[model samples]
Target: MLTRAEDGLENLWDSRRAAGMSEPEKLLCRSNLLGSDKRITNYGGGNTSAKVMETDPLTGAQVEVLWVKGSGGDVGSIRMDGFATLYMDKLRALKGVYRGPEHEDEMVGYLPHCTFNLNPRAASIDTPLHAYVPHRHVDHMHPDAIIAIAASRDSRALTAEIFGDEIGWLPWKRPGYELGLWLEQFCRDNPEAKGVVLESHGLFTWADDAGDCYALTLDVINRAMAWFGQKTHGTEAFGGPVRTSLEPRARAAVAARLMPAIRGFVSGGQHMVGHFTDAPEVLEFVNARDMARLAALGTSCPDHFLRTKIRPLVVDFDPAAPDVDAVLGGLKASVEAYRDDYAAYYGRCRRAVSPPMRDPNAVVYLVPGVGMITFARDKATARISGEFYVNAINVMRGADAVSEYRGLPEQEAFDIEYWLLEEAKLQRMPKPKSLAGRVALVTGGAGGIGAATAERLLREGACVVLADIDGDAVAEVGKGLAAGHSADVVRTVTMDVTDEDAVAAAFDRAAVAFGGIDILVSNAGIASSAPVEETTLAMWNRNMDILSTGYFIASREAFRLLQRQGMGGAVVFVGSKNALAASPNAAAYCTAKASELHLARCLALEGAEKGIRVNVVNPDAVLRGSRIWSGEWLDQRASTYGTDKEGLEEMYRNRSMLKRSVFPEDIAEAIYFLASDLSAKSTGNIINVDAGNKDAFTR
Candidate 1:
């Protein structure tokens, strides 16, 4: 049975209000409450609204306003500003001149003009639908149980049987002003009805109060689930579990061989990242006897058209395939065939007014025995698309278990695939970053320099693997990055860089996670300070193990993976300014850095043949968050400078030509430039991120 979060509704509202919740905040809370439950909505799906009273600037009087969730705001963590307040009367007046269908653009344009507040947030495309409803509160969500019935061939009859006359049904209509008007009129006619179901779209439940509306929505969904359970006699979705002969290691090996081939075919010269998954559920579903036929029907809902397209590409696989090359060839052929079929489908149903055709590549590629591959311009988008397919697979199985699986016709699918609103949103997005489809690995990722570099790479649209000996700290760092991007973009692995076995395992995990790596940041190191006479053997070994030998191990693994993939890549070693400008008590420290710098140059000379570029970033005195500048080291540096800790920090900042303190982020930016294609032709070079320390300049 599906879980419902109706407990403590009144208490939650009271607590939120006492904590100073505005109308929008309350609405956001409700939206998040619904969105938090995956069964109710997935990713950015679903929207909510509340009728609020706001001051009219012109008349200085209170006015009724509709505060609704805005586009691109995930309902789970929506903020107060996430809502766009619109004048209800102005939106209602728009229906008089509504020119039937093909008004998606016109309607979208009109909604913004009707905003009560001068703030120009784009309300959801379903704003008109919410405005037309008479209730003080309204919600629309795509719940799995409800959609399973709605997407079935018998949706209308089944819905009627379940709800009787408590709810009304609207035939599938493209969301526009006209449909909103029809929904308003339908609600007026059926005043006794609790809500309405948009056939093959979603559910709308409303009440004068927010809590009641939410409760009603849950009650209705619970009824649907109960009915489905009785009909299916409690059989689990996908029938029975099907075990795979290949274990995890073998599955990853197959994925490693097939990922590049699939990416090569789908990318068509443009960059694309491929993500593989062999979760227990995925393995069972893909291995089912009739997997291909079942998945070929269509997406679980029209909302998925932009992401997963109408259907997934199901690649035929034989577990007994003789070699990796054979499997790769099969994967390549399947992708090419999918592209051809997609072109044909588009040709048959495209409208003259349709937007330019998107790349004819399938977002989802399913390998029956191995697993599934999801592709997109970036790792985050690829993972989101993959998640949608996972949910759809479940819904499809449920629909089959209860009734027959049916989806929208080809023309209907084309309509949503080319929807104007979706296109407009895409146009407004910033262009993909230079490293959009690339994957990066950073050592010392739990600390200052490594974490900052990882964040910079994430912003540039590269999937990152953060490796550090601090396992828990790196996990927390990964969590923070995941919040801003997709979880697939940042992976954390705990490793002592000196361990060859650990380094190999981390690289292997990264390859399986994001197909392969494109950039390597060898930033992991320890700092030691002592005169040649006072330097201890233990201190010397520690510095060399983590600094010189550690860098060699990580760089070698990176080279191995890039060689295996036969793709050109970049590697940046994080050497120190001390490598060039030695300080009097830094014997072991300076020697290890100097050696590492040359190591990078050596790799560059050899790697150039295979299209790999190697470089070094030398940073000086980045002490704010540096894990290296602490404990007795701080006191020793202060004493050497004839001052306290704070004065010594100031002395270092003034010593630089820029007369400013260098930050870890400064180093990250330099690393980013070298890691990206912007430095494609430049290698065997050193970039200084030391706020202009003249003594450290290579020239």
Candidate 2:
């Protein structure tokens, strides 16, 4: 057993754990262990494989099969189905039909024919690299320490010096069938080698036994880390910090201000979700004197640049004297210049067969004092892209510390970026949902209609911020929704809509959490049942305070963010049928609801110039799952109808012209229609979900 290196990787292989496992299970265990540490491999950045003897379905005979991590799978979270299975003989047979390098992409087309047992999971491009290696198990990982050496100026010489003939080195080659053949040739040429390093790529280690492969992979990475640590000890990173970092709160404030503006500039094609990280390493690099020079060199690993783009746009912001206004003033020009530069790069690097230039916007943005901001079509992708960039930063730190760092050549990077295979994979992806890039803030989100609306929007791919006065209840609702959808798209805030400061802060949080809000479901409310003569001053004010004043406060905040984002948005108010038809003994509720409806119209008129749409969905007697109906409102309404609480829903149903009961889901459907682009041309419109109430009819 190897002892753990100080601040280096640990040998996580366990003999006991592997004692009773099958070869495939052992491969899985090895992969999870290697992938658990970002120091070992980033999310979805590496592949692992094993050759196992399996029963042939057709002939009931034993056969060799290759089981490798499937396309678009993360090793740490992968399951059995995540591995693509292929017949070893059939994979070997591919070489006979393989053409030269120019026709390499067509080889991927033949991979499906090599499928073992009709496994539907698609094989990754790295499939051949593992298939051609004459070993029972193989591991390919992009560990920062290993990539540091791989990306160094003297990477080939450094590999020989460190491993001393035990590991070999190969020059940069884009991953495909041709590279796989090169690796096979390397293994045969250096029979005693434990593994080989692919320059500007990653590490690949293999052994006949799964445990040995796992141990060897860890050992190689740990040795690289130890070497880098010794060489770089007490050295200045990125030529030392030129700017100090802002305090955490101040950093957040700066990010909150910059993200919406940056998001606006980049989100021309589709709305982008933003992620912010002020990790120590990110701050170190962004604040350094060599930051721009190093960042402009771009990332070394294909996995890094594929997500982060060729390079990040470093924003001009000073930490000592933060002129955020100056930065904001020049942001448009800076962004446009970056886009122009990218187009020029594409123009210079394009081959006759290269795909057309994609979105010209930058994916990663670096602000010296604030942090790193990454934007993508959705929140999870934005977050992952930031993580990959952090890996690139670590690689740069180590490589620059020892030997000069080198990114991939522009032509090579461009080929990989616009590779036809990658384009095909992207084309295979399912269409995005209707609200795929939208962010929504739902008030009273713990209540029935509010939760339903949130759920509806979430299903259509909107990231939702659930804001409510009941913190615990809202948290529970958010948690439940996060379980169904991912936690990345669901956030909860404790908010009292009547509190102006609280409302503003919630909007800021939403901006920080999801770039900015694209939809505001103004549904926070309170219902009071009292006769005009019996209504106390406090009761009337309470109704007006939450219903009328609260709507104004939330809408005002949403409008501010939407205007800042420069993206038109949707605002759907959850009004009451009482707004149109007077209900006996509920004068305060009726009046406040009426005020809410008119406020929607007024805001719609004001917001139309900016492309912001304001609409309302009026619901009547939606008792199921309603928080309002769980309290005094239910008893009061039952009393007014001279019936028990059990009969209230039925009475309301009978009262409607259609004799159909309205539920929170029914109202949610109306709200969704108003909030999505289906109602893009609609503003100042009222959608009544009151089961054909003649009094509430708009026409």
Candidate 3:
């Protein structure tokens, strides 16, 4: 008796596509189709399952196997291996042993015993909810439209009004064994019901057919959306807008300043990457009159609360009289107050056996007129946190428009937040890489050494911003790196190192893109090989403009941003062996390189107090993969050394103490050491990556 709505949700299921699919494959297809839309569920926020008859590995007898999305898996991107297989009989038998809600945490340990075919994928905590549904297929989703109704003050009445007897409703209870049983009982009572809405939680739908189950989930959400649309039509959302939004450029400028300041305060233990959004929904909610009241109440859904924290820190900034500097000055105090409030919440809610308090810092920050900013240990998490807050905002908008919106009770939220199972999940997460939360900005990033350094940093879990004069080349390199590592960690900007404004803008972009920069690799340079008699003013100026002046500008901008962040930073200058060896017929290049080396020493001395370390990596004859070697500089150096272009590399190698050919990757390795914590205590020093060049050795 289920009817599909004319609008709101699309039926993406291709019967042709599912024609040859097995039951497990059909379940996966349905899960993916449902998860593909943000309107259906946020990332990693929903679970889907199917009970299929599979032959037992040992007995060769067919049994009902429950295939469900495994722990920490996103249905949209899940593969066959991501589904945990368990015996349905064993799952049902768990009901007899389950004592009560107080002992629900122990039930998670019993899941592994119910494993069918020894599937290695760990079953998620929501397994019982799907197992107890009493249907061949089940879907549990956190669609915004459905959650809007679930989180409303009259959630039960609203559910009845919208779907009548087709869908049932359950009161708020933390998701676990008891709630799964509650779902089973609800089904047993309402035999005509197709699904049920869990108050302040999400929607659960079931069907004997996978296609019908998928369609029912969409149909239920669509009905809710349609009903809310009609009931709340023409109503003001979140009590309407109280403030005007700043222009796009102005908003970005404010975010560039505010993000780094906030990052400095919260990143005391580890660096945090940031994500900023000025989407229409975020702007509408932040600028609304009831923003403070609604945000204070917190998010209703446990998934939303978990990612965005109990509540966001509302930044004190008025768009009417925008003064970003004033906001920046008071940022530390604001952040500290939020931490103190969070600590007090923990104190009031902590149980005798509760896990120790986590990072007291706020994850979401709301600035009226600008937008929302979220920070986490890494870029993806930060971005995902922002998305979850947007979902919360949508829920509030709908719930407040029709009926009063309700957040979970404080004790209930506290129990879920500090639950032992949640703590164990956190403990089981893999240890983060050394450079996990660090962000780096590399000049000349399109070049071989620059790209290699970016790769090295990214491999160790650092976000990298590639800046270079060649826009196309830098973008191409950024694209390739983004493909390897995620696009979240790689950003590219076209920059002229000698242009003061361009240099500052690039750093600001870096701040807005990934919070702020922690490491600066000053590698932009030019080479000119002319005898003293032939060295014109133009040639000398060109070398100095790029090598000396450019390095100074880039470093100065990096220092300014690092100071703004209040976090210590690293500056690694890509100098040359010629700076010390006094190469013939290259006076201009040698002089510029030496200037760069001396500048690093001065910066090292000045920045030591602030924990910013500056050092130099000197490479002699980096002929392979070097843009300098690809140009006229190679022919000029070969002519000077009385050798052909092909033999020039060999001549330089023979001149070195080790007689080994140097490549860009070799130089990159030295730069990485100097830029990372490996050289934390060794500043104002020079590393000769010239394959053992005695002439370039520092005494």
Candidate 4:
């Protein structure tokens, strides 16, 4: 493990500095690898930089440039532009700080001009410190293993005992101008201090040669692990009698508790992918002893606190027990105290703008063996915290043996935890609901899938104008939906998505209906499966015209309307998973879907400049009861599955890992989530409804 870790670190570090590497490509690659695992860094947690030689425009000489990670990028998914370039000489020049008139303002102007794009990206507030690192390839990470050891009792003593004098440990320091000065001098003083361990926080390693820098990180993790393992022994803190299962009743109860917040957050427009796990780890944390002892005990490496808040809600054992209410009440009360404390800490250290309100997402369970629980806007952060908790608990056990785990000082941890610059780094893709309060002219509203998607958006507070080629039939369908909600909530339009004039009329009617356009769900058309050779031109155009073009015309009008409104909107082309995973007789059907897919992407980028959000939903096989299944179709599916009607229904749907079929409502729910603020920062993203078919989909 040590060797593998060391090798990976070395390769990543040295690859950037390698002569063969393209600078922009190396910057993005570095960010991608560092962003992949929370064990390495939390959400937007780490920064990577490369010192490259560039020509001075006026001086006509070679100079060093520092391309550091940019703000608003998730390292896991940053692109080439995510690296902001700074003139190394300018950064170095700033080191000679003098209180003068043009000092700060001059710095800001130079800061932007130094970028690869002349555009300004928020610089890491720690720019001075990163710029000053002697190494060309420098990385900073808040690794769990290191932090666990750092937080333990006797951490400083244990660190000294483990590393001898080669390691330099710094007391927690405020991480901006002063910290930058301290780090520069410390590196100067301890020329042999291979790695710097910031007490209670993280580690910093650099390499004049990137490979050496990366190697030291692994070496540090290994050393920290060894010290931690020796510190805690024979305590089966994580391993236990094993939880047979979570309370089945608890699922519904917890779901109930989580629902309101989810609903309020989504505001009833988008459906939440919720239902929590009392997974063994979650249960273990909940039932552990001394849970909720202090909120900090189980926090996700401090950085995560920026998004999911700082601590989780630690429910008690026998969570259903009435007494649990009293405990929960206390937890809520503690929230104010935590918020007040964090805000106060911000005020004490902050010299600039105020920070966002403080709240924690991690909570320790009171049960001796119970673990912790965390919540996130999406499944990703929750999973990050879960992994962090597992590794942390191990570190905690280790610390118990070596000495108590020492963590960052509360305020310093809070500063990093609530660091506004870091928090603001998350690139929030504009959520697509810019169409909310708008009218959409869906081409195939009478159809199951189109109707389902329309329902999803209507629930999102958008006014929908349901249109279909089968005008009369769709009018009736829209009438039915309107009755269920409000007649005005849905207006029926009789226009074929395939007909140009009709498509225009429908848009006109929508504009008349809703007074403006906000969101668009362009789902309309038919599909006929046939072999490529057997497919006729006529068959291809029929499907392409009625389905893909109909969607196009509707989308085209929606795009125009969205443009006129001067606000962004989300327009989801109902694409099929067949586009990615081909089927036997889907050649022509496939091409049209592929065309719409590309169209959505092109528009996503183009509309991005317009504040418009565009994306496509490629749902796998959808077998819902709306309009897709006529009596004959149902009978055929039932007979093919060798089951009775009910069994065939379940068989058709319950084949996914989640053991559920792709329902029209499910598609609607997923689309609603994507169209709302939940996916505000998620333009150009495709969501697959396929449940774990390895060939199924992509993120």
Q: Across residues 128-218, which tens digit of lDDT does each residue of candidate 4 receive?
A: 6678877677777777666665666666776687787777777766456556667788889988877676765667777775445555666
Cand. 3 Cα-lDDT: 0.93
The better candidate by lDDT, 3 or 4, is: 3
lDDT tens digits by residue: candidate 3, 1-699: 324457688888777777899999999999888889999999999999999999999999999999999999998889999999999999999988998988997999999999999899999999999999889999999999989999999999989999999999999989888888999899899988999999999999999998889988888898888988898888889999999999999999999999888889989889999999999999999999999999999999999999999899999999999988899878889999999999999999999999999999999999999999999999999999999999999999999998999998998999999999999999999999978899999999999899999999999899999999999999999999999999999999999999999999999999999989999999997888989999999999989999999999999999999998999999999999988889889999999999989999999999999999999999988877778888989989999989999899888889878889888888888888887888879889998888887777787
Worst 10 residues of 2 by lDDT: 1-10
Count steric clashes of candidate 3.
Answer: 0
Query: Candidate 4's error at 71, in angstroms?
Result: 1.8
User: Best to worst by TM-score, what's the order?
Assistant: 3, 2, 1, 4
Q: What's each prediction's TM-score?
A: 0.86, 0.98, 0.98, 0.55
Residue 605 displacement (Å), model 3 = 0.4
Off by over 4 Å in 4: 1-19, 23-31, 57-59, 98-110, 116-120, 238-282, 294-301, 308-310, 319-401, 406-699
Backbone clashes, each candidate: 1, 0, 0, 52
Better of 2 and 3 by lDDT: 2
Where is model 4 poorest over a 10-residue stretch in terms of lDDT? 266-275
Pick by TM-score: 3 or 4, better one: 3
lDDT order of candidates, top first:
2, 3, 1, 4
Error of 4 at 196 (Å): 0.5
Give the better candidate number (2 or 4) by TM-score. Answer: 2
lDDT of 4 at 636: 46
